[model samples]
Target: MNAAQLRAAARARAQRWLRDRGYLVERLTPDELRYMTSWSDAPIPAGQPVPQRDDPRLVALRRRYDELDWPVTAHSRWSDRSFVDFARFRGDSLYIWHYRESPRVSALKYFMFLRYVEERDHKGWLDALGEDGAFGCWTFEFPGRRPVSRDLLDSVNELTFLDRHLQLSGWDGLRALDIGAGYGRLAHRAAQALPGLRDWCCADAVAESTYLCEHYLQYRGVVPPARVVELPDVPSLAPGAFDLAVNAHVFSECPREAVRWWAEQLARLGVNWLFVVPNEADGFFTHEADGSRRDYREVLEQGGYRLVVDEPAFADPAVRELLRVHDRHCLFERDRP
Candidate 1:
């Protein structure tokens, strides 16, 4: 399908998703909507050309994401419950920032315990950063039950494996690259969580994400540590210069060719370790709009990468065991002879 057809399908899907979720369905007070629409780097609205997609479905989904349009409006799905949760997390985060703890920090381990599905863990923020003065952040769903946002949680969780299992530490000291990094979340986390982290690259296939991350990292004061590497620049980087590379969120939504591109790119880039959270039920796979499946395992193997770490989303046994739904995360290492 062409761009117009793709846009229409995306519009129908997003409108249905928002409407069904009662998003944009009501007005809210300023306090109730404090962080909702307050994001400075929110994406452009839908019906706009998105960063140029090579795949029609990807274009449609990117359009859909814009339609979801976060820094959610009061009229959007900013629920009273979500407001309470966000406020509570923010309050605790601020307290943690001050190196003071809140009782809410403890309550975080139990919040939304059932929805521990997807990359988002089921709770609030609890852990303080090892980095001085960086304070508390909401991170880590694996080895579950931390008081942090899903994004942060996912970052810490992914990093923990590298830290504890792979014997990698201080991301600043290593050559690091993040593929498909959106808005520089991991970059922010690495800067915050690993104060010693020296060099990091935030690369994305999406033009909007690449642009947003470039600005977002600077806005978050993590610019030098987390530089945005645009798609066109990927080929220019020195090969075998990266020790680790990360991919999160929507990678599983990629088509076969996209997966191959990533694999081949990482292989050529000489990245040793590949970390991903594919969101597949059992194994690494991406399903097409037509129900065809592309198992990324095949692509990775063909690229001379192999799975080394595989487990439930959470590192904590209890968190993984207590999960109402199961999601697995896998780590792959590039081992070309």
Candidate 2:
């Protein structure tokens, strides 16, 4: 089929799949649910009068973060409120003030270290993003190594770090799916990096995020093969059985239902490869968003996937051994059903 025909099929299949999964499409319309609010809230339209920059709530949240010794604790507990929460927080307001704009030390340090600090090669990779502050990232001059823009850096690092394993030969007709794809940061990078890709689907559970990603992908010129798939439509829109399915720093934050559901979806799609990254150490344990603790391995096994490669998010062998406690990045290959 022609490219237009292919896109039409994907759009229709995706919408049909979402409706079957019980998501309310009418609610997603801008006239209805305008903005995303919280993890539990459905998409809703912004109130007629949006808050101005100087709004008291905005000032208060900014103050709350600014005053913190750290936006997240080194202990990395969910209750301590790690970057995991910040990434998945329900509303556009929370992300805008706390992440996209705020330069509080706590926010800066938290975003910086998790991916960039240990991943030494990221320095050269970041050149594509331009001056740090230009992208809402505040830079600190650290001797030898510098970390910047938590989400953006991490997104690029994941693609490059994992490149050793994906062995992407060409972008032509290549397909990818990113689950819990926050703001399409990786999608933006992938569009520029992977020139031949035929389809790159960004899926997220938050309605507010769907609105944001659609515009973000377009703004970043990732459309054609790069498109936002409403979270529920995941099962139907495999797009040539997605060459890679990414669950970057996301699965661990999911509830038991969500974790298992995503596992099964990727398995059902027969995806060739799966990438998993987390905010914590080497063990399989994760305290899910649903308040349930789980070992993500169980979900992977249930979905018929197997661990093929395990490595630190940072590639240095000495560093991996030195930092023995943390298990940051992993690859799981589907065990052909």
Counting clashing residue pairs in each candidate, in order, gives 20, 9
lDDT of 1 by residue, 134-153 (tens): 11233223355333354444
Q: Quick one: best lDDT, which candidate?
A: 2
TM-score of each: 0.59, 0.60
Where model 1 places Cα greater than 4 Å from the true spot, the runs are 1-147, 170-172, 289-291, 315-325
**Candidate 1: TM-score?**
0.59
What Cα-based lDDT does every candidate model obtain?
0.56, 0.57
What's the lDDT for candidate 1?
0.56
| Tens-digit lDDT string for candidate 2 (1-337) | 9999999898888888998999744324452232222232233234422223344544454454344442121112223322323223323322322232223333444444444444554434555542233223233344444444444455566766566667553446788888877667677767766667777788865444455566557755669778987544555674356888887766666555566777767877888788888656665655554465678787787888888887776565554454342447788887764
State model 2's lDDT.
0.57
Deviation in Å, model 2, residue 147 alpha carbon? 10
- The stretch of ten residues in a row with the least summed lDDT in candidate 1 is 72-81
